[model samples]
Target: MAFSGGFGVTAAQGATNPNNDFQVANPPNDGISSLSWSPTANFLVSTSWDCEVYCYDVQANGQAVPKASIKHDKPALCSAWMHDGSAVFSGGCDNMVKKWDLATNTPTQIAAHDLPIRHLAWIPEVGLLVTGSWDKTLKYWDARQPTPTLQVQLPERCYALSCTHPLLVVGCAERHLQIFNLSNPQTPYRSIQSPLKYQTRCVATFPDKSGYLIGSIEGRVAVNHVEDSLASKNFTFKCHREQADIYAVNSISFHPRHGTFVTTGSDGVFNFWDKDSKQRLKQMQKCNAPIPCGAFNRDGSIFAYAVSYDWSKGGQDPMASAQGGNNIFLHATEETEVKPRPPANRVGGRR
Candidate 1:
């Protein structure tokens, strides 16, 4: 609570208006590229294209503020929290990876990539940190060691990465998909062309770690199973899009316990899906702008999403700036906006 001592203004940042269903945080000056909740606390950390990162306290019915902030020389593209929440790891367009210590509020350069580091995956079980860069390489880092333990070259630059413990899934340019077991970093367990033709925007694995979901800029999502027996169950669907206009699937997240997951897109919508059933669970009120990212708390009881202009410029609209497109929303998992509807025939009889 030391960071929250002085900056708890009720509604000063971004749009101050608040409501019952959604609570908007004091957003960054630019689009939010990534968001991650601390595994041990009711806190959230986000990276922005404004070359800064913001931390928020998300307690029950609490207002979010800029509890702590850090600025980089260039846009911070991605971030992850250490298992214990003692520190955070951030990667940026500056081609640097920094580890920010929470207690001391200091940052240390841990690794450097040849190009902008777009994605990162931290495996707590093995104490291994994997960084994927636009330079088309995945570098494995052990904080105790000065140099990377292993590096694997790829056919194309990395676009998205997801981890389920020992499994590391990487989605790269040129419609390539690779899955590696962190225990064996030399070769991928599975390597194949992405089911979707468009570039990947985001990726997330299932709660059970059986497979993963990869979303594309063309408003499509594909399910890839890790086991061959389940491969027949894999499928793809078109989502977060409008008639004639295509929007990027900016984020994908899975609920901690349920088989359900959430998808956010440049189309200004957040769609909840039951992956096993392949059905739209519910759609929340539109944000009126592109949504760059979404995240679920460790227990999956709360869901947070960033409604900002997609910095990618894939849409037909002009680029979003600080003046607009920086709203962060937090909603409960059981909120009426996302609850499944009762069967029409079971409702009050109107015969």
Candidate 2:
């Protein structure tokens, strides 16, 4: 509530103290890197630059503190929960991907990369875990096997990744956008240049699997369709920019049931948009710091976003120490909050 420059009423569940809603496991010494909610339970997992992963029980009374913490030798950059929610998988700067069993709280190292593992996505239907690394490679692991099932060299160092069923999308260095059919990893089904003029920061697929949204450091988003015939529908737009500075678009997540999606940025704002209509539905409360990541629950009833200091903030006016601190925002996703309506056209109007 302290940050300025946002419109509309607050959309967070706990507005009085939004930071308290995250229920951090403990005060971390460094910025938070990633966050993922359990697919079934009201639990959440987070990675931090402090080289630790904290899992919290959000349903607990009072602030949902971390129920467990898993330490890593290097800064943990990304994490993903298995489809059944039985365990968690994390990757970090140490170039290791580890699987932690929630029942026993024991971590088992699974795979290793030459460089930092920057992104992870699990496809339950295919029983595969895909990891993208700064080493310029994409590795696929089968749950039943200990070694990677496939490894494909990328055009450049990987920066962002997203997957939905049969399709996998990766954004790498120098504006390379690569799309692969999960059934065949050796060849890419679609390869294109990102529309944005800067480094790709994040990517998320549409709920319907038609295309994906790509975010960049220049505060712009590019909408891409999978089919060559639908290429005409693709477009790019600028968002998350301030009056005097351009902020990086940090994360983009699509709602589970609705096709609408939300975007977060270094500008400290989370905005909901109907990609089909290309209109922003609502602008959520400002966090007063960069939002590193965001996610929606399996049922799309709850949305979570992480607010923390970003490397991009270095060398600017000194921020209040607390302002640079980390917290998660658990916001409610209601029909009134995200569903597009009214002059925006009828529900089935878009074709």
- Residues 1-351, model 2: lDDT tens digits: 111112222234353234334334364567788888888887778899999988887652324556998999999999999999999999989998999999998998888899999999889978888999999999988756778988998999988998887888999999999998878877888888887789999999876778999998988888889898999988787788767688899999888787788888988888888877667787766666788888877777667777778677676636646574676666656676578554544221122
Q: What is the lDDT for 278 in model 2?
A: 64
**In candidate 2, how many Å is residue 172 off?**
0.4
The segments of candidate 2 whose C-alpha lies over 4 angstroms from its true place after superposition are 1-27, 60-63, 314-317, 320-324, 342-351
Candidate 2 local Cα displacement, residue 348, angstroms: 22
TM-score of each: 0.88, 0.89
Q: What does candidate 1's lDDT look like per residue over 1-351, in tens digits?
A: 222122233444333222233555567887788999999987899999999988887765546656788888899999999999988999989998888888999988888898999999778998978899999999989976778988999879999999987777899998898988767878998898888888888888776888899899888888878998998878888887677888888989887766578898887788887766556777666655777888988877777788777755755556443225576777667644344444332111111
Worst 10 residues of 1 by lDDT: 342-351
Output the worst ten-in-a-row residue range by lDDT, candidate 2: 1-10
By lDDT, who's the top model here?
Answer: 2
C-alpha-based local distance difference test score of model 2:
0.79
Q: What lDDT does the true structure give each of the candidates?
A: 0.79, 0.79
Any idea what lDDT model 1 has?
0.79
